[model samples]
Target: MQTVRVELGERSYDIVIDTGILSGIGERIKGFNFSKVAVISNPTVFNIYGDVVINSIKNAGFETLNVIIPDGEEYKNFNQTYQILTELLKNKLDRKSCLIALGGGVIGDITGFVASIYMRGIDFIQVPTTLLSQVDSSVGGKTGVNHELGKNMIGTFYQPRLVWIDIDTLKTLPKREILCGIAEIIKYGVIWDEELFEFLMHHRESILNLDPLPLTHIIRRSCEIKAEVVSKDEREAGLRAILNYGHTIGHAIETETGYSRFLHGEAIAIGMNREAWLSEIMGFLNRKDALKIKAVIDSYGLPSELPEDLNADKLISHMKLDKKVEAGEMKFILPEKIGKVKIQKGIDIENVRKALN
Candidate 1:
């Protein structure tokens, strides 16, 4: 297993990535001093790996309660979290018990949110089952649900006990889902690693086909980059904001479309381009570099632009409510080049509209 450590002092944890690692999670959890485990997942994921994960926990001497929610971004709200908390209480899960998030980003977010608030806080392991979750959401301690006005507006900075990623799960994902994950992988390249950008460009065909070697490399490097960032800024105090390179507009896109029209990373794919264009408008990113970024997103078979039906004004309104907003000015994380980004504050609302146009 490949382990990436998120060093947050006592709150530090390991992100373990490997094929067939799910079956060993129980043994891993036992070491965390948690006796009971609450397995929170959606129906689809439960149907797929429920037996294996549950049995593994049971074999490792853990009393387990499985809470299955409906699968979708729309379901990631207080209602679902309330249900999970109710199940935890009904199951008599205490601080000594841990919650294991066993699905994609939604499951991990809601489960971690529930774990954070339950009896002050409880241990939770992120068992991300999708490409998008494995590469991005699972490694970060940011956990929350979307408010009607914003994405991840109702969340907390709660780290997990462990992040267990099994790359084998990618095989079951649909092509659209694969593309959604690629959007994030592309974002990492744009924000932090120029080498990763070129590496992705060179292996585009292999990555598109989910060839194991390229996929594993993407997962490992992406997690390492995120883990390093989180270690420095555990609470988004300063350096961590760069991780939101395309997220301000991306969150707005997810909210404006009601989280139905696009996947999380798909919305971010559009957001990345729009924000990069914003960089160009601000005289930060040159047009040639901006177009280079957009072209790469296009090559991934993802949407590199916002949907026409989305109203620019509505997106702006949603963005004003984003967590990144400070003093009535939304802070935009824009790319200046393939491997570097800048957080531009005091952004004019009109400029955002222009980017949408």
Candidate 2:
């Protein structure tokens, strides 16, 4: 197992990445003292690995409760969050209760948010089942549900007590979902590590084929990069914004189409292409590098363009409502090169429109 510690003073925790770690989760968590345990997950995930987690906690001798939410980005809302909180309250779960988020980004976001607000704060573990969560959402401590107004419009910086990533869970993920996970994997390389980017390019075929060796390396490196960034800027006050490389436009695409239209990573894939093109026009990224990014996205069967029905005006309206906007000025993370980026502010709407097309 590869372990990375997120140093956050009293809130610090370790992220464990390995194959088949799920089976040993109970033994791993036995050291923590808690009055009760809540396992928050979606139905699809529950059907697959819920038993393993529940059984482990049972063996650990803690009173446990399972809260299963319906799966999908559309279900990530205040209603669902409230539902989970109500369940926790009904069970008389105190501050000593621990939550285990056992699904993808949506589950992690909602559960972590609930943990943050329920009784002020509670300990939680992230058992990210998808590649997207394991590498990105599960590590960062940024948690929230989508408001009707925007993606992640309501959230908090609530760090997890621990993040256990079992690569074994991903083997059961749908192929399309696995590709969605790759979008974020690509983001890590584009914004931080050139060597990692080259590694991805060289093993693109192997990654797509779900070869465990390369997949494991890809996920671990991505988590390492994210952990390093979060350590430096846990609240996203500075350098952390670079991690949003594709998110500005990506969030707009998701909101305009409704969350159901694109998977979070799919929207990010489109966002990366659009932002790369924007960078090229701004004289930062060259056309060849931009195309290289696009080719990698296309090679994995991810979308590289906005849907036909999407227009500049609708997208612009959504962008204006983005959570990253400050003083009504828009900020974007644009590529400077294959492994470099800058968070540019006051981006002209005209240029954004041109890049989206």
Candidate 3:
């Protein structure tokens, strides 16, 4: 087992990583104040590991409430959040009772949001099953639901009490879902660690093969990078914005597709490619490096282009409403090099449209 710490002073928590760690979760939660625990997951994920999670809490002598929502990005909304909160009320759970987010990003995001708002505030634990959630969504303390107008437009910065990552859960993920996760892992390399980028390039085959050693290294390194970033800028006030390198246009794609067509990482893979192109055009990145970026993204078997029939103008319109917009301008986390990015603001909208085209 390995641990990464998100150093937020009073809110700091450990991200524990290992295989089959889920079985030991009861021991991990032993001292928390909550007697009754709520496990929030989607029907699909709940069907897979529901019994084990419930049994773990039960063995620890805590009452467990199962809250299962239909699994999908479209379900991450105010209505679903209301449903979880209603369950808490129906069971008469107090603020001391913590919420356990036990699935992928959608489950983690909304579950955390529900915990943040229910009865003012309640602690939440993140047991992210998917690679996307384990590396990105589960660590940052950024929790929210998507709005039709834009993705993650409605949200809050609330940290989880603890994050328990059991890589064993990934065995059940589909190939497509694993690709989605690889996209985010690539993002960490692109924005921060040059060595990580090189490591990914060298181990591309190992990653595709899902060998245990490389997989463990990737997760631990990604978590370490994310933990370091969030520790410095917990609220995304400045430095942390770089983490959104591909997210500006990525969220737009998810909204345009009604959160159905592409997974979050799929949209992000496309966004990162487009933004790299834009950066090259703006002279921040050279064409050689830009193409290399796209090449790596393509090698992951993820999409790097806007859909053939999707309208560029429509995408720009959606981007205008993104949460990253500041003072009427869309801000982009543009890469200047493989291991560095800049939070570029005041970009011309026409340029974004051109990149989309």
lDDT of each: 0.88, 0.90, 0.90
Question: Taking the tens digit of each residue's C-alpha lDDT, what string does model 3 give over 236-310?
Answer: 899999999889889888878877899889999999999998898888998987888888888878999999988
Ranking by TM-score: 2, 3, 1
The clash tally of candidate 3 reads 0
The order of the candidates by lDDT, greatest first, is 2, 3, 1
Candidate 2 wrongly placed segments (more than 4 Å): none
Writing each residue's lDDT as its tens digit, candidate 2 over 290-326 gives 9999988888889989888898789888889777889
In TM-score terms, candidate 1 sits at 0.94
Query: Would you estimate the TM-scores of all the predictions?
Result: 0.94, 0.96, 0.95
Give the better candidate number (1 or 3) by TM-score.
3
In terms of lDDT, the best-performing candidate is: 2
State residue 316's C-alpha deviation in candidate 2, in Å.
2.1
Give the clashing residue pairs of candidate 1, or none. none
Relative to the unseen true structure, what is the C-alpha lDDT of residue 323 in candidate 2, on a scale of 0 to 100?
75
Mark the 10 consecutive residues where model 3 has the least summed lDDT: 146-155
Candidate 2 lDDT (Cα, 0 to 1): 0.90
Q: Which candidate tops TM-score?
A: 2
Model 1 clash number: 0
